[model samples]
Target chain A: MIDLELERFVYFADLFGIAIFSITGVLAARGKQIDLFGVMVLALATSLGGGTLRDLALNAHPLIWIADPLLLWAAIGAALLTFGYCRFWVLPRRALLVLDAAGLALFAIAGAEKAMALGFSPLIAVIMGISTGCAGGVIRDVLTGRIPGILQQDEFYATCALIGASFYVLLHGHLDANLLALSAMTLIFVIRLLAIYSGFRLPVFVVA
Target chain B: MIDLELERFVYFADLFGIAIFSITGVLAARGKQIDLFGVMVLALATSLGGGTLRDLALNAHPLIWIADPLLLWAAIGAALLTFGYCRFWVLPRRALLVLDAAGLALFAIAGAEKAMALGFSPLIAVIMGISTGCAGGVIRDVLTGRIPGILQQDEFYATCALIGASFYVLLHGHLDANLLALSAMTLIFVIRLLAIYSGFRLPVFVVA
Candidate 1:
């Protein structure tokens, strides 16, 4: 059973994650010829696709968005806000990357916790967490007709989520759940920030 | 409840659909410089992605591939065969199109029937059917770095699935299940073939 206090924290984290991811998706579509409907669809896909997949894989009923319409509204609101005020925001590339990392961290922890609460195995929970953190961006890239950075750049993005999820799963029973969740999210965010600044990347296989 | 005899027929059709979809996915990857593992992943995604999404949306537990491992093996086997013998097969473009249409028809009817069996509304059932018929191809196109043909070409491909699914949902209670399933499949297949041969397409939107 999830602690009511932790559940409340998670709810806020989820909303922030949705808004940030939606903003990133809208930014990605800046130069694309996508219209308003397309932008809204892309934003929703980027914000909710990961959680939806994780819920489906875990057999969680009534998908989260269906359960909480507010999440959908949050994503749509973010998209509209971004669409209208993008020029004014003028966020630097580094700022966009930071926001994306923050979203990834929140999603990774929340996904892992949800899976564990649902009684999934630790490995499955970790996979779900990593997928939740990365799949949305992949979907956004695909919709925008770009090779997904996860498949191409290998900038330790998914790896950070995987490590954080593993940390959460390993420490959850021994430590306080809320503390562990926060620490896991922080760990992922810092690691991703470092990887981005340091240009760290995984080695690619070269076919002989 | 699904009739045992009809279930058996649907099972075989599902396997054939998996194989054909896998082959098409592999063929799509031919010039993309993707490695064997990448090709296998793409094939599995294209073959099973649609049903997986449909099952998840309907809250079906033990996803179809998990309940039946043969579907996975069939898809993997088809991918391996295509990877090794694509050059030798020399399939005409027309034959490939026909095979894809057949897969779409089978998946559409089966998906709609399954949704109806699960007691979903007819509208939702038809949507599930259309999703199951077209989602795999969309995934394949996206993964291959091309815009989904369904979204762009409007060659009546998804429209055929929509019509057939509606037909199945509307007639299933009044007709024998097996007869309706076959009729729906034939309708989609014939319409798709005609669309292909006649170069039929929906008018593209022109932004003013």
Candidate 2:
């Protein structure tokens, strides 16, 4: 069935998303003087947290990473690579931003699809998508003793995910799979990239 | 109704649990040089994580602290107490160990009782109780960039909660309420204290 192909594609995207998040997590661990074990834990938490939370919230059985250990291995591999070659990697920060944008788009779409599979309402599905795409980074920051960037009302990080998730819900079954995926990814990537480059930010709701 | 009284007692136990956990969290953050906001967040996460997890797993609506801002204020009060007086109220680690034991016992009982009230099986209730009692500390450790003490094959932390949870479940509705509470609390406290004083620990399991 076409649905099977879609699922496979989404799973592949999920793996890439995991790798990106893991690499970012490893990078954050730099300058903090954490040992190798601490770095690995942060990497795992960053890569898997969003999906684990989504599964928990939806009461999905077996949790995604538990079911497919390949993602876990992939995250470990990515973290190891980052750790070993970070000094040689040119412009690590820029690379992280681009990969993070790709991950946000892919994860948001994947989360929305999963939510739809579970028969959640459109709004709830969208919310779940955003939560799934962003919660991992939030958990990573909190664990590393940083203010969760997502909660600080800065950065176009979660906003892009919300937009991509909405796009997925709108064009899920109406268009070709590649086109929809590309469009959603482009939407998130472009917005996030622009925000990073131009310093675009949303207004904070300061409590008086 | 008896159910009402039981609920009230569990609620108070949970509040006390939060206060105790917040104090520890605040103490943990003291030497780390985190800002005031970060300190409050660490305290809140340690105090509130277990209950939030319990509510989410049980599909309980309007999460406990979110429903009652009073609990939030109480945790803040506890955090402020730690920030203001931790240096002055220097107790021996053994004395603090006693406080930790009392907190662990009360939280395990409270968590199990709530799960039972939510109609989960006794097994599930006990698991929930242990998770609710210990997961906050796990979260705190992970966030502090350290391995969670419970995750390691170290002191009898979660095991004590697990034993107390099993005892409470076996005795549920059989004995009078006061006796049940006292026995469960005393069991966990005495066991944990003895373990600490006697240098008892579980063997490590390292997968080759």
Candidate 3:
């Protein structure tokens, strides 16, 4: 039997993550002049793309959106809200970064936990976690005709996900699942926030 | 029982599609200064992305590459060869177009057949087919930081795949599988080629 508190946490995490990612996707398309249909597509892609890929890789059927139509509605709602309010709100760049970081952390832990539940190996679980956290943004950037920031920028975004997922995998068996997940998510979020504040970046490989 | 001869034809078609798509992906990265690893990643994404999505959607486990290592090798070999010879061969633009069209037809039919075999609805099968044919190119363009040609260009590329896939689905049970598949593939290829040469294009959606 699943723990009720953990289930509730996961439920909220999933919804908030989807909403934040969808908003970010719509925000990214601000100057692209994409139509409303295009905005909805981008929002869906950003909010669900990673989980969809993880499910596909794991051969999990019916997909999350297929199983839970509420998630789809949430993404659509977020997109419409972003489209309507973006011009008037003029959200600060820092706010967007913080929201993205929170979504990344939530997604990373959820991905790793799902993979572990599916009996994947720890390494593969960690990889899935990172992919889950990053793939949506990659798809969003690609659709908008920009090189993915995760690929081009030296930011520690994906790296943070990797580190947090690894931590969760290492600690899950020894600790309460909820506590372990919360710790991992906090680690990812803190690291990301620190990286953004300190202008921290990884070194790029230069092809000679 | 699956027909052995038809299976053999599909096997060859799948291999050729992967190889051509891989090469096209590598070629598209030209002038982008992407590293060798990046090239291989792009090639794999281009050759396998569509099928991967289809398999995921259909809940088909053990993806084609995981089930058969040969497909992976083919993609790798194509990437390496393209990287080495692209500068020397300087393939004609028309030749590239023809090759792409052939791959599109092959992939489209293969996708539709796989979906049908897995008991998907006809409409979903056709959608998968078009996605299989066009997704590789979409990924390739996205990786190279360009708007997908299928999305931007007015060419009847995806439309050709759609028509051919619909034709295949309508006729598959009434005719020999191999003959029907070949007919569908030929129709797609010929229409794509004619569209290329005659400048046939669908009306673009102008955002007012």
Candidate 4:
């Protein structure tokens, strides 16, 4: 019973995250004069990439995209809609950053839960969360020649995910599933949003 | 005896492919004014993205990049060197395209061989081959906001890989390993180079 609900909740998270990420992806493609194909590919990369990495690392079968055709269709729909209206926006950039942060939070929690369910240890789950939260955007930025958000020292992006994952693991062990999940998501969302709004940042250091 | 020699050959091919891909990735970062960290990441993505996808699909352990530190080091070194000479080249664009093609060919055949060795069916091997050959470039292009060569109808990039993978599978049962690999690489290289040079292309059509 609880397992089934968790599955459905994760599905919702996946759908919402994909939609948000796809919108951001389309916005990122602005001014580039890329065709519809290019736009779609970017959207797909941002939306599906993190999950693909997570499932692969966990060695889970029938990759999420392969298992759920609806997700891909939804992503494509989101991309199409974003591509259609992207040019009309006065501040697509601001919308993109906010939505991207939301998607990152959703993905991070989803990744942590999935890794835990797969019997990975706490450390592994935290890594999975951060990786799933950030790797897609990193790949997106790298492909588009934009500076990957990860390598930058500007924002508290992946670090927020790390903290949230730890919080989730601790909370999940004590609470009901729904509350646990919601609390985890809230922790990530609030932390990331506050960091962005407050201009909190991580330090950059040169590795020798 | 033959098996050991084949492993050695593929190992060298992997290094060469990684180097070429990294060089191109570094070159792509040029004119983008990306920091050194961004450049190394882009180079790493281009060099290792294909193999990582292949390893994930096959449920292989440690990821190729994680298992082999040498490949990562080589990619970083190549990126730094390419970044240094990025401004000196008169035809950086042409160099990027040709080096990309070389990496494509090497990765395609190498990926096919890896799949075949894993006892995957020939069709799966061919699909894996093309996926492994082209995924990294697709990733690189998407990050840079450029059109991925495979998605474009302007040239027959992935088609070359498909053909070579099929040919390699046909030869797998008959020829010794070295000859089989050499033949496959040659076939893909010739086809891709001809397509690029002669402007041979596949037609673009929306899926109906």
Candidate 5:
């Protein structure tokens, strides 16, 4: 019973993540002067690109959206909603960041959990976690001809994901699966929020 | 016996295409100031990104590189050779362009053939063909913070690929497989060469 409840929570969180990322994707296309269809494509790319890449890398079949039409509908609907909302009011930057951190936490843990369920190695699980939470935004930025914030070594993006995924992988067999997922996600969300406020960055690697 | 020989021929052509793309990848990373490992990553991304993507989308297990170590070796070797050669002397621009056209032709047809063999529709096969022929370069360009030339409406890059793949799809049952692949590749290569020499431009779509 508890497992079922936690599973539903995770599923709902996943939907929220898709919506948040789609909103960010729609906003990212602001100066590009593309048509509505192009915006829709961009939004889908940003929300779904990460999971799609993860599924592909892992040979996870049917693709998430293809398997469940609701994911696609969520992404498209959120994109359209954001499009409409933005016409009247720009979303506050702080709110988006806070929501994004929550989304990232959910996405990272979900990716890690999926990989764990599939019997992948811990390292692979952690990497998938980072990619699932982060690759979409990278794709969105790169398509717009900008260096991605993650790759730019901007604060704690994939890094927080890495830690969250690692935490899940470490405690997975020891704790209840449902509780562990929430714990890991909470850890990531807290650290990411702290990173945002603290503004400390990891040392950037430069080629000599 | 004939089938085996043709299969071998295609396999060798795939290796050659990998080498060519790896060389181009090395050349593209000229000013990036990345280390040797970074160069190898770029080379692999350029050579394998498209096929890996196609396989995942189609639910093909065991990525091509994971299945055959030879492909990865080809990419690494070609990248190293290019890195050494460029340190001594630059490759002629004309030579690289001709080789790239040949490689593009092979990659596109190979992608289409794989999709067709899996029983996908002609349209899906064509899109896969374009992606296999072109996505690597886009990833490489995007990683380095440049909008890819393919996305820039540069030339008949994907256009030539689309025509070639369509040709193969249209005549698949009627023509011998080996002959069809070669013919389609030749058609793409010739038209790409023509596009380069004639400097014809596709109408760029711009929103008013």
Candidate 6:
């Protein structure tokens, strides 16, 4: 059974992740010249796309956004803030990347834990975690006509989520759930940060 | 309430649509040099993507593919067939387009009917119908590194689906379901075909 503290921590982390992802989504649309309604749609899709998929795939009714309207506001508010902020002030790119990494880690862990709570197997939990972390970005990239970063043979991205999710699911029963989630998120964040700084990439397979 | 004949007819039409979409997915992947497994993944995503999203959004339990394994085989088999055939024979591009149009019409109507059967609003049914008809191709286009044709506004595509779905929802109460579905499907097919041959396009909105 998950402790009350872990649930509370995850709820806050999820909201933060949604906001961060929404910001990234808005930023991705900078030159697209999309209308405000378009920006809001992109923000919502980026923040909620993965969890919505995860919930539906798991047959959990009452989508997370439907269950809690605050999450919708979180994404919308973040997008509006970014939409307003970028018009007048220069935003730091590196800081956004770091925040994005953190958001990815948090979303990944949250997704895996939800799957685990739903009694899915470790493999499914890991897959759902990675999907939760990465799907929003993919949706954004596709909407903006850019090749998805994760689908490319570059950076840690979903791989970081995969390993961290495995770490959580594997050690979930033996360790405190709260401690395990933090460690897993830290692991993903650190690995992603390293990939960002070092330009580490996966090798593409060559077929002859 | 849907009669047994209508349900049976829609089921067969759905299977046909699934196969046509899978073929299109496989065709889109040509020259990408993706492996067979990647091709299968794209085909499945293309064939099932829209329905999966529609089901999730509507909180419909046990996804179509999960409820009936034949649907899974339909997509996979179609992909494999296309993959093998394309290696030895030149595919008729026009033939494929006509079939794709038929598939689109069938899927849009089927999706609308399902939503209506679930007691959702007419507007929700139309939206769900369009999503179920178009989402899979969007996924395939993103995966294959192309701007999705539906998103491009160069053809009738989703607009045809939307109109057909609306037609069905508007008249479902008074007309014979089978006859109405056929009329709608024919309307979509003719419109899509006209768009294909006449180079019809929606005017792009310009922001100054």
Clashes of 1: 0
**For residues B140-204, what per-residue lDDT tens digits would candidate 3 score against the true structure?**
78777777888866668999999999999998789999989899999999999999999998988
Model 6 per-residue lDDT tens digits across residues B46-110? 89888888887897877777567688789989988887787778787787688779889889988
Native contacts retained, all candidates in order: 0.12, 0.04, 0.16, 0.09, 0.19, 0.08
Q: Provide TM-scores for the models.
A: 0.62, 0.58, 0.61, 0.61, 0.61, 0.61
What DockQ do the predictions score, one after another?
Answer: 0.11, 0.06, 0.12, 0.10, 0.13, 0.10
lDDT of 3 at A60: 79
- Model 3 docking grade: incorrect
lDDT of 1 by residue, B1-208 (tens): 3465777767776888889998887777655556554566678789998888898888788778756778978998998887767645565566668888998998888888888888999999999999999999998888888888798765679999999999999987798878788899999999999999898998888899
Off by over 4 Å in 4: A1-4, A87-91, A203-208, B1-52, B58-130, B136-208
Name model 5 segments beyond 4 Å from true. A1-48, A57-59, A64-137, A147-208, B1-6, B34-37
lDDT of 4 by residue, B1-208 (tens): 2456887788777888999999988877768888989888888998899999888877777887789999888888888888777657565467887888888888998898887887776766886788788888877877777767555556577778888989998889798889889888888888878987898765332221
In terms of lDDT, which candidate is stronger, 1 or 2? 1
Tell how far residue A182 is off in model 5, in angstroms.
22
Error of 2 at A166 (Å): 1.0
lDDT of 6 at A200: 74
Model 5 / residue A124 / CA error / Å: 14
Error of 3 at B101 (Å): 3.5
TM-score of chain A of 1: 0.95
Candidate 3 structure quality by residue, lDDT tens digits, A122-147: 86688679878988988898788777
| Top lDDT prediction, candidate number | 1
Error of 2 at B108 (Å): 16
In the order shown, the candidates' Cα RMSDs to the true structure are: 6.6, 8.8, 6.7, 7.8, 6.9, 6.8
- For model 5, how does the per-residue alpha-carbon lDDT over B48-129 read when each residue is reduced to its tens digit? 8878877878777687788889988999999999888889997887776787788889889888888788777776687678
Q: For model 1, state the Cα shift of residue B29 in Å.
A: 4.5
